[model samples]
Target: MSNPKPRIALIGECMIELQQRADGSLLQSFGGDTLNTAVYLSRALGDSGAVDYVTALGDDSFSDAMCERWAEENIGLQRVQRLPGRLPGLYCIQTDAAGERRFLYWRNEAAVRECFTTPAAGPILAALPDYDVLYFSGVTLAVLGEQGRGKLLETLVEARRRGAQVVFDNNFRPRLWASIEAARVAYRSVLPYVELALLTVEDEQALFGHADSEAVFAAYAQLGTPEVVLKRGAEACLIRCDGQSYEVPAVRVEHVVDTTAAGDSFSAAYLASRLLGGSPVEAAEAGHRLASRVIQVPGALIPKD
Candidate 1:
């Protein structure tokens, strides 16, 4: 008989998002890097695999709406923990004339900061090894403080030993980290256990100070990861897998609206395609195709239609 479909758990936080217009009005929504990946990955995988979101949130109306929305997307919510008297983080995005965006955050006391430190985290961490795949991004590491990161690293090591594939996306946002050295240490700690890495070239450069794609690729190669995919916006994504390298071109978009989740969406499709048995080249193509469409929309998520 064929093997059972794999189960994937993406760990991170989902926050309340506000987009500030030139007129000084704010449009409200929900967005987080790993959450964006979870939603897109679930949509890309459909019923082929089980996709679950693992996070902590407050028992508020906004949190309720977020959970309701995830349910409608067919994402599993069994690992979500509700904390009383706490609420999700909030941030406002302001875009320039060139569509470049800046974010102002109000998330220091967010409930998710305590996610991996809560009593409920013990069972969740213990059960993580049972999944076929575990995915997270740099933002996940940033939110989970040093102690929490140590715990998460231990869980990742155990999960890998149990044959779970650990997929990581390097979605680096410098302001989220206390210091560049701290971020470097955290990333380096997790690199050895990662099976597949989906990296954005720009973010890699910003985080690690790599001069170019070759430098980025060289750095990951030193980590001994077998599969690495590097995404370069509006250009080809470079892939190195199974002793072969491939360049997959991105689909050109005429008009770009919001590039908020372009990398997140790409990571989702790439991982989804691989989980479905697609080769690295095919997976890269799928990622680019999805991201091309995502950049045309105004928010992190686009309408299913």
Candidate 2:
């Protein structure tokens, strides 16, 4: 008999997004790292697996619109929290002539910061361990603060104990933490529980100062993570799976439009491929295929076909 559809939950913040055009006009929308993954994962998986976005949002219109968009993608919304009187975070993306983008954030008072602190969070925390796969990123850890990070770590422990596969992405943003030491402490604490790690070579170098991809792979090896993928922009991605390593070249894209959500999109396709029984090489190819198409678009989410 075929296996039942795996229940996958992606935990992170979804912010109100603004895209700054070259003529200085701002287009409003919504996107986040994990939210990008959730959307693309839903698109790639279709009805093959269950995908959910777990985060808190305000009762405001922006939050309402974010919900509508996710639901339109067929992503699960049962665990989403609507906090009273709070607001979703906002960010603006500016792209250079080369299509490389930078962000300016005004997210200090976002509702997701209180995601794990509210009284309503108790049941949400309790329900997390029942998932078949739990995915989160370094941004998820950074935004959670110390207490929330501790709580999330504890939940990861319990979830793994219940046989959930823990997937982590090291999408490290230096501006999010008080100190590199603090980020290191938090990342180290969660590393052992991770079964699959999706790492960006540059982010790993920025955070832990891994001199090269070898050092990054060696570190994850020490942590005993069974699967690891190192993504390098416009270069080959390195993968270690099932006690062997594979180097897969990225799909070439001419005239890159926006590099936003490139890694997020890759993670979505990679995880979807793996969950659907594709081999590691096949999964990396799937990741490259999706991400190549994403960067040629304008926003974190491209228009559905």
Candidate 3:
């Protein structure tokens, strides 16, 4: 008989999103780095695997709506914590004529900040290692703060020790960090435990000061990360998996409406394909195809009719 469906848990924050239209109207929604990945991954995997989101939220209406949306997408929220009297974070997206996007955040007091540090988070942390895969991003690290991060690192160590593969996305946002060195130290502390690393070329350069792609791969090689993918917008993505390298070009799109969630969507498809036993090259192609379509849409999540 075939193996049982893989159980994966994604840890991060989900925010109330505002997408600014050309007419300056704001389209309200919910999105976040790992949450976007969770939605897309659930859509991609269907009944092939189980996807759970691990985070903290408020008991407010917005949080209620977010959970409703996740349920519609078939993402498991068993690990979600509803902290009394707290609130979810918020962000706004502004797009340029070139379809590139910028963000303004109002997430300092979000309940996810207490995700791993709070007493209520203990049970969730203890249960994380039971999953087949544990996924998170740099944004997850930034929001977790020092104490929460310490708790998270301990959980990751225990999770990996129990045979759970750890997946990481270096979705670096400089503004979220107190300083460059602090970010570096946090990342270094977790890098050795990662089994797979999904990285963007620009974010890698900005965060690690790597001059080029070769340097980025060389650094990850030192960390003994077995699988590494470098995502470059509009350019071919590079993959170094199982001691081999491959370059897969992105699908060309003539008219890009909005570039929101491009990387997050790509990461989701890539991880999904890999979990489904696709080769690295095939996974890269799958990621590019999904990301190309996402950039042509207006929001982080496309309608799932």
Candidate 4:
């Protein structure tokens, strides 16, 4: 992006997080892959850029607290839609000794499933093309469903035509899709409009059956994506940009408390550094530093300090 501090809107769901402690107690919090990135992106940009979250919620106290927290984090609330009878989704996080996490979801009927289908979405959709950047994830595609996704795809088409950069992260979850074929269709449909793709090697392998980073890069290249970052956990991230490839090493960490938001934090710092006019290598380094710190913490969101 040309602007040092660009206007960015992240589209996805934020759920009530129930993190299971070692003592067998549940710790309440708010977290989602895209929401984690939004909070970190807002912090990384400070007052220089704009970060907005686009989603739907209900009239429940949980939803109220979510908006309150997002406001506190400096994420814009203008695009939030409120549905009277529905409620936000919930999820539980379980981490093993290695800090690798597993998720249990209760969100088949989340309010965010209707985020782009509401009456309020018309204005939000209209305003989207004006932003400097539009960001979303594979999970965002999964939850938004058919109708909501249609609106989002249409907005992305317009946004691209108006010169807005569209960013996508491949944070895939198999359980969220009806089949692997369905996920492939969804991903392929939106990829043509994407300018930068923040992809995890595992996700790309699982989603498209790519055997290695070369295959992943070749596939995205064939799809005509300008830039792609292939993140391999604990290994160096490979960046393919401007027809050049660079390998930026990940930070070494002896301990990982929870791997919940490692990739989210990485993407946040990467985007922030890019907006601040850093090169691909510099941005990837920033991502590694932030992700190294995030993995040392226990949750999706670490302390701002």
lDDT of 2 by residue, 1-305 (tens): 01268889999999998999989999998899999999999998898989988899999989999999999999999989999899999999999988999999999899989888889989999999999999999999998889889889999999989999999999998899999999999999999999999999889999998999999999989889999999887898999986899999999998999999999999999999999888888999999999999999998999987
lDDT of 3 by residue, 196-224 (tens): 99998789999999999999999999999
Tens digit of lDDT per residue, candidate 1, span 120-208?
A: 99999999989999998899999988988988999999999998989999888899998999999999999999989988888888888
**For model 3, what is the error of residue 186's alpha carbon versus the real structure, in angstroms, after optimal superposition?**
0.4
Q: Write the per-residue lDDT of candidate 4 for residues 158-266, one digit (tens) a residue.
A: 9999999999999999999999999999888999999899998889889989999999999989988988998877899999997999999999999888988999999
Weakest 10 consecutive residues, lDDT, candidate 4?
Answer: 1-10
lDDT of 4: 0.94
Worst 10 residues of 2 by lDDT: 1-10
Tell me the spans in candidate 2 whose CA falls farther than 4 Å from its real position: 1-3
The order of the candidates by lDDT, greatest first, is 4, 3, 2, 1
* lDDT of model 1 at position 305: 78
lDDT of each: 0.89, 0.92, 0.93, 0.94
Cα-based lDDT at residue 14, candidate 3: 98
